[model samples]
Target: MLGGISIWQLLIVLGIIILVFGTKKLRNVGTDLGGAVKGFKKAVHEDEKDTDKPDADQPQSKVSHDEAGNTYDVQAEEKAKQKAENNDERK
Candidate 1:
């Protein structure tokens, strides 16, 4: 009845899985599944908490400058352009 799956269907699926991955492997699978479910629950709770608070540290603008005299945003753009040009040359 769990997730609309009948008992017989569940048994058949379990049997197939057991045949494919033996008992020891199935135990590992169960542990992995439990870990994944726990992680999912934690993630959902974290998302709810995040939604309740404002993320002040996150920047709204695309460009960020450092204390150095050198302009980093322009330098990054130039580097990306050079990389694209190099890729074009290779092709």
Candidate 2:
């Protein structure tokens, strides 16, 4: 018995796989399989969040820049703009 699989069955399955895809190629198959599984889980989680959220017509938060050109939002757009300006000055 080949690892609890009948010897004949194991040999036939192995032969078919080796013929279709060489041993060297099959070696990295596990990594590819794991990546696909990880991506699937990420997509499922994102879908769940989207479903939980209301429609676009629902009033959502938005950022508006004041007369002074100062931005207000969850993130500091003013700080980001200042950083970009500084970088431009360096160049």
Candidate 3:
């Protein structure tokens, strides 16, 4: 028994399906389903690849310059501030 249904019972259900929606229709439906699944998988993989890549148009630098021409790396400045705060706490 397959899934608690006998082989003959399964065959009868298959026959009914074939009779309702002939062989060609069923084949087309199967092909369309497979294509949809393949497209979904391809889209998912493309998204994953996109996320892994950094955008080419955007700047990668942490440094920024002000209108007066002063330049500084924001990340380094933040780290320095945190270190000072930690030192103050230790005291």
Candidate 4:
């Protein structure tokens, strides 16, 4: 019994999901999800490279954010704060 659910119960839920969405649809969904994850990882790797070779003219936003405005790195927050201060000073 895992998490108060039996093996049979888990199988039943899986069967229902399979029935509802069919095998082909599920395969497509899995493929799409894998592609999205691969793209995200590639972008992050590129972003890391860009951060290493800093550009003077373009302000680098080392920010990796989510839909709800949640930042991935603590350093991003500090950089944003510093940027805000710099902008405020210039005005």
Candidate 5:
């Protein structure tokens, strides 16, 4: 038994799922899910490289200004925070 369920029980659940979605649709779903996971992993790897190399010895957030004396760093920080929020929402 595994997790309070027998092997036959697990097989029954799998059978039900296969019956409901059919083999072809399930295969396509699995392929799409795998591709999505691969793409996400690649994106995270690339994002890490970009952030780590650019500010290796400094903080992730920095301060800057424009000709009109408007602060830009805070805007950048807000954008980054919003991006993080979006990622969390996806999860």
Candidate 6:
């Protein structure tokens, strides 16, 4: 018994669903669901493969410059923002 519903009760509910929606429609819905699950698994597997390998093109530290020609550390900027937030909260 699942949630106190007997096998016979489950069969009746399934029969009603089939009657409300034809077999063909149900089959199509099932096919679409299976395809979505398959694609999700494939994407997760690819992500795992990507994380396992390190690329040479990616630098150990990343830097970006602006039009004003000011140089700043990427991590330092993040820390600065956090400090500003803390100051604002204190005020």
Of candidate 5, the 10-residue stretch with the lowest lDDT total is: 62-71
Measured by TM-score, how close is model 6 to the native structure?
0.61
TM-scores of the models, in the order given: 0.43, 0.47, 0.55, 0.55, 0.56, 0.61
- Candidate 2 lDDT, tens digit per residue, 1-91? 6578898898899999999999878878977998999999999999888888778458777986566855558467788988999999999
lDDT by residue (1-91, candidate 5, tens digit) is 6789999999999999999999999999999999999999999999889877855777567665546755469888999999999999999
* Preferred candidate (TM-score higher): 5 or 6: 6
In model 3, where do residues sit more than 4 Å from their true spots?
Answer: 56-91
lDDT of 6 by residue, 7-85 (tens): 9999999999999998999999999999999999999999889887877457678675556766669999899999999
Residue by residue across 1-91, what tens digits does model 4's lDDT show?
Answer: 6889999999999999999999999999999999999999999999888778747458667885457855489898899999999999999
Clash pairs detected, candidate 5: none
Tell me the lDDT of model 1 at 3: 92
lDDT (CA) for every model shown? 0.89, 0.86, 0.92, 0.91, 0.90, 0.92
Clashes (backbone N, CA, C under 3 Å), per candidate, total 0, 0, 0, 0, 0, 0
Off by over 4 Å in 5: 55-91
- What C-alpha root-mean-square deviation, in Å, does candidate 2 show against the real structure? 7.6
Stretches off by above 4 angstroms in model 2 are: 1-7, 55-62, 67-91
> Of the candidates shown, which would achieve the greatest TM-score relative to the real structure?
6
How many clashing residue pairs are found in candidate 5?
Answer: 0
Error of 5 at 84 (Å): 57
Model 2 / residue 62 / CA error / Å? 4.4
Candidate 2 similarity to native, TM-score: 0.47
The alpha-carbon RMSD values of the candidates against the true structure, listed in the order shown, are 10.4, 7.6, 14.0, 19.0, 16.5, 13.1
Off by over 4 Å in 6: 56-91
